[model samples]
Target: MKIDIVSVFPEYFDVMKLSLLGKAQAKGLLEVSAHNLRDWTHDVHHSVDDTPVGGGAGMVMKPEVWSECLDQLLGLDTSAGADEPSISQGPIVIFPNPSAPLFTQADASELSGAQQLIFGCGRYEGYDARIPDYYRAQGVDVREYSIGDYVLNGGEVAVAVMLEAITRLLPGFMGNPESIVEESYTGSEPLLEYRQYTRPTSWRGLDVPAILTSGDHGKVDRFRRDEALERTSQLRPDLVERLDCSQLDKHDRAKLGALGWDLSGEHPRRTK
Candidate 1:
């Protein structure tokens, strides 16, 4: 897969060259390039932001600068008006916005299959809304996502967080591909991953769960599955609320029921 990142602080992405991401680049499995948004500026100061039109507290990233950068990156014609978009089918455009929907593992999974991605990282308050609006109107697959509820100074960090999640799912990107299957937030019915253990079963004083050491693989799997349910319920009941009842076996139902889950509803929920 290919990715282009546009940020005023492109140097922040230099770390992309040091890890498994770098190895993927070496093997030709991925291509990532970070460009300075200022490169598209024509003025001496290379100004990319301006006071908000509505008298906001912080400066808003200028739409004109973003348009020039995004247009060239998206292969859209600057000359083309709102009626006629270059209509690129190959690359999907993404912008990070604090007010947008949360970026999820499911989204990352889906985007891992894209041929190319262009990420525009906004600084100051944010880029003008029309940037994404105009592109979407032109038949482009434009997406805006927030990493979380909190705000960040810029989108560069959010882009980095999202890129790691998406790129690691690409085929051959991970050394052990199976590791991706059972991880938390994966699968049609996602769950928090079971706790991991390694080395001496007894570390200091705390002992590993005895079931893990037993020679019975079936029992170990069952134990892990049960632990996953319990852990997720304790940590992220929101995931539990969305559990697909059809996918739950009798044992699974019993386990959740024991944990105060009310299975009688149209959807699973914790009555308490």
Candidate 2:
């Protein structure tokens, strides 16, 4: 896979170039590049932002530099359709923002299959609104994802997150594929599962669950599912609805019900 990042802070990309992603590049499985967004600037200060058109709190990234840089890198006219894949092309413009949509495991999986992925990191309040609209007109799907509820200084961190998340999902990135499938949010189960540990048999007076040491896969799976349900109901119940309980037999529901779990209704304190 080929990944391109457009950001003012190109140096921030060193993290990606030095870790697992770096190894991927070394193995010839991945090609990643970070371009300084200001390179397209023609001014002495290389100014890329200006005050808002109708008086806003912060400056907006200028569209000219972005358009020129994108055009040169993509080797296409500014009005060209971004989705037109010829002999070699990939998805471009995965922007990070507060709106747009939420990034999910499905999105990461889809990105892992792409031949090329481009990220546009904006700063100074926001980018020229027209950029996304323009890309949308060209039938290109530009994803604007928010990492969380809170906002960040810029999209650099968001880009880092997206890169790592998508990169790790690629084949051979990890030694064990089961690790991904059984991960916290990878499978249909959206909640954190019950996990037990092995130690002094007791830790701070809290002993590990007895079922974990029984060496019974059936019992352990049921215990883990029940614990997952309890934990989700207590912490992030909103996720419980998304979990795939089809794997659960009658035993699973009975265990959860015995623990005062109300899976049929929203959590007592609903946030979603």
Candidate 3:
């Protein structure tokens, strides 16, 4: 996969050169590049922001600068030439903003399969809304996402957070694909992952669950599923509410009942 980032602080991505992302790039599994948004400026100051049209506390990112940078990266030329494909044709464009919909693991999974991704990192008060609006009108798969409810100084850190989530889902990026399957918020049901332990059976007087060390694979699997259900029920009841209870068997229903789950709901009728 190829990822391009446009930000004033391109150096913020230097950390991507370390750890799994670096290895992924080294192995030809992924290609990531960060370019300075200021590079597109024609003025001496290379300014990329301007005061908002409406009276606002912060300056907004200039759309023209973003347009130029995107055009260069996407090979979109205004001059009449061979019918050149628009950059939006191949790359999914993402803009991080505090007011946008929250980013999700499911979104990362979907984007992991894309051929290319382009992130427009906004700073100050964020980009002139017209940037994404213009691209979307031109048929670009544009998405505006927020990492969480809180606000950040810029989108650079959000871009890194998103990139890490998407890249790890790419094939061969992780040592074991099963690890992905069993992780929290994955698979058909979005349950939190079960607690895990390794190495010392007894650490600081806390011993690993006996079911894990029992060598009874079936029992261990049951324990994990139950733990995941319990954790999700306690922490993310919203997720539990959306679960497809029809997928549960007699044994699963009994376990949920033990946890005080209401199985009388139309979706999960109690089995005789």
Candidate 4:
């Protein structure tokens, strides 16, 4: 996949060269580039932001410079959509905004299928809202997602977080593709992964679950399923709320019942 990042601090992406991401680039599975947003500036100091129009506290990124940068990258002749690249020719455009819908594993999985993606990193207060609206009207597939509920100093960090999530899902990117198969937030059922243990069965004082070392795969699988259900219900009830109760077997329901989860409804809920 091809990935383009537009940010004032292009140096931030240098980390991409350090790990599996770098290996992906070397293997020709990925092509990544970072472009300085200020490169499109035509004036001295290459100013890209100005005081907000509605007397806001912080400066808002200027759309003029952003438009020039995006137009070139998106192969659009003008902001009005002139000579706009088609779905096949253009890449998906994304912006990281704290106020936008939260980014999720589902989103990452979907984007891993795209051939190319361009992420615009916002600074200061943020880029003009019109930027995304304009491109969307021009028939570009645009997305604005927030990594979390809180805010960040800039989009670079959010881009990194999202990029890692998406790129790792690409076929052959991971040394062991199976590593992602049973991970949390993946598969038909999104649940936290069961706890893991390494050798030395016995740790400093605690020991690996007896079931794990019993050589009984059936009992071990049941133990893990029970643990995952309780762990997810305890820490991420929101995910649990999305569960399809009908899919839970008698054994699964019995375990959840012990935790006060009411599965009679369309979605699971903790009674108390």
Candidate 5:
């Protein structure tokens, strides 16, 4: 996939050259380029932000500068009619903001399938609201997302977080595709991944689960499933509540019952 990142602090993206992203680019599976938002500025200071019109604490990114940058990247004619056909098949545009919906693994999976992506990394307050509003009016696939509830100084770090999540899902980006499948929050029935152990049979007096060491693959599989269920129930009951109980077999239901999970719609009570 081709990705274009427009940020005032383009230098912050240097970390993209270090790991899986770097490998993906080297292998021709991905192409990433960072552009300075100030490059579109015509003034001596190359200023990209201005004081809010209604008077706010932080300066807002100037829409005209953002328009120029986006137009250049998309090959659009700024003077053309708003109803005119887009100059190019525009890439999916992403704007990271604290007010938008949360980004999720599902979103990463969807975006990884796109052939092109463009990220607008906002600084100071944020992009003028009109930026996305204008593009969306032209039928462009524009999305505004937030990584979490917290705020950040800028969207540069958010872009990196999103890129890493999306890139890893691309085919051949990961050494083993199975690694993606077995990870938490993936597949039809999402659940936290089972705990893992490596190497030492006995480390600091804590031994690896004997079920793992056992040659009985079926038993090991059952053990892992149970552990995953137990962990998810203990940590994220919300996930458990969303589960399709009808899909569980008698054995699975019995296990959940043992864990005080109410299978009959009433609140569960521990049975000693």
Candidate 6:
């Protein structure tokens, strides 16, 4: 997979060079590049942002700079990645903003499969809404997303969050394939396993759960699932609502029934 980031702070991505993503590139599994959007501007100052037109408090990123940078990066008019036939399929363009759609774990999983990902990281105030609006009009698979209810100083942090989330899901990025299957939000439940303790049977004062130490894989698996379900129900009831109860066995159904989860919830009924 290939990923290109367009940001004012190109230096912010230097950390990617020392981590798992860097290793992936070295192994020829992933390719990532970060470019300064201002480099595409024609002005002497290489200006990429300006005061809002209709009356806004902060500066707005100029659409011209974004268009030029994106067009050149994707080889829209030139022979860039043109040799790569998949480039024409279109890049997944993501615009980070507070008012945009909420990004979920499923979105990250889906994006990990894209041939190319192009991130438009906004700075200062934000981009002219036309940036995302125009892409949407072109049938481009662009997504405008917000990390959470809170706002960030810029999109750089959000871009980092998104890149890491997608990268880790790629096949070879994480050495272990099993990690992806058991992790939080990978399947039916969005909740992660509850807190765990290890070794030193008697810690500062607390003891490790005996169920974990018992060498019986069957019991341990059951215990962990129960803990995960309990944690999900307590902390993120919404996630519990999203699980298909029909697939659950008698034990799971009984447990959930006791917790007030009925047949009608956020998820579809299990098929088999």
> How big is the RMSD of model 4?
1.8
- Regions of candidate 5 where Cα sits further than 4 Å from its true position: 80-87, 265-272
C-alpha lDDT score of every prediction, in listed order:
0.91, 0.77, 0.87, 0.92, 0.87, 0.81
What TM-score against the true fold does each predicted structure earn?
0.96, 0.86, 0.93, 0.96, 0.93, 0.89
Q: What global local distance difference test value does model 4 have? A: 0.92
In what order do the candidates fall by TM-score, top score first? 1, 4, 3, 5, 6, 2
How many steric clashes between backbone atoms does each model show?
0, 0, 0, 0, 0, 0
**Model 6 regions more than 4 Å off:** 78-89, 263-272
Screening candidate 4 with a backbone cut-off below 3 angstroms (N, C-alpha, C), the clashing residue pairs are none
lDDT of 5 by residue, 1-272 (tens): 99999998888888888888898999999999999999999999999999999987989999999988888777676575666746576589999999999998899999999988999999999889999999888777999999998999999989999999999999999998888887788876677889999988899999999999999999998888888888888887667776777787687688788887887753333343
lDDT of 2 by residue, 187-232 (tens): 6566666765777877898988888888899988877877777877
Candidate 2 Cα lDDT to native: 0.77
Candidates ranked, most accurate by lDDT first: 4, 1, 3, 5, 6, 2
lDDT of 1 at 38: 94
| Model 4 residue 112 distance off true place after TM-score fit, in angstroms | 0.4
lDDT of 3 by residue, 204-240 (tens): 9999999999999999999999999889877887777
TM match of model 2 to true structure: 0.86
Q: How many clashing residue pairs, candidate 6? A: 0
- Once all C-alphas are superposed, what RMSD does model 5 give against the true structure? 2.5
Question: Tens digits of per-residue lDDT for model 1 on 117-228?
Answer: 9999998889988888888887788999999989999999999999999999999999999889999999987899999999798999999999999989999999999999
Error of model 1, residue 103, in angstroms: 0.7
